[model samples]
Target: MNASFSSSSSSKGMMDHGDQPHVLAVDDNLIDRKIVEKLLKNSACKVTTAENGLRALEYLGLGDDQNNTSNVSGLKVNLIITDYCMPGMTGYELLKKIKESSVMKEVPVVIMSSENIPTRINKCLEEGAKMFMLKPIKQSDVKELRCQLMKYGS
Candidate 1:
């Protein structure tokens, strides 16, 4: 846990927790984003968020359809957490974009949503989502995130 980035619920909700590895969260809901932020705060991990997949790609300097730009500097995002449904691009679409991206294919993604449909779950897995957590943002989810950090921190 080193750096943290958060976007404000009301006004873009941007927070910079320094240069640590980041967990990019893409969720349109303010409360959900806040909960994730609080949970990761304890671990001191840097967090960045986007309301949609497009914005997330911009933050990472990725082009349309998840293509990465080699000119960008210091854009090393570790994990991504997104909600399934959104106004513009769905989480699955975002995941697809990430997977298609040149250098981002290896980045792990976690899908968090209220939808429990098997189709959605299977779709996320097919798109390479590393984990799926049903919402309303439980403490266990936080613990799981911590475990993931531990497992991948090396």
Candidate 2:
């Protein structure tokens, strides 16, 4: 699978929110990924995207290299928003990986899904997810997202 990475720098008409929060959004669906990228950018966030959990890990500088804290672009990721269900890795699994890693543990992670399974939500939260959002995320959700980023963006 070809994983595409996009950032606010590559887009047109994106506002320059100076020193804005940087977010990494991961999802398998193209439409869903685009929606996340657009919404975060609209909210004045510097957004980046990956098509899967593994690609997201790569972007987070957690690949074969031992220095997982160093991102490829050298951008400090403030928060991570990921889809709950995906082909290779579930959001819960991704959350666990992030929380386990010493370098990436401080970064906040949020999970999104169309399914509102209480068990799934609880599992994600237990695994260190900062928040769980329902699918078709709206503009109203951006406020909470901003809050999470601010709380952990340091």
Among these predicted structures, which one has the highest TM-score? 2
- What is the per-residue lDDT of model 1 for residues 116-149, given as tens digits with 9 covering 90 to 100? 9998898899879988889887777877876785
Tens digits of per-residue lDDT for model 2 on 63-148?
A: 66775567887778889999999998888888898898888898999999999999999999988898999999887787789977
Report the error of model 2 at residue 57, Å: 0.5
Model 2 C-alpha lDDT versus the unseen true structure: 0.85
Best by lDDT: 2
After superposition, candidate 1 runs with Cα above 4 Å error:
1-21, 64-73
- Evaluated against the true structure, the overall lDDT of model 1 is 0.73
For each of the candidates, the C-alpha root-mean-square deviation to the true structure, in angstroms, is 6.1, 2.5
TM-score of each: 0.79, 0.89
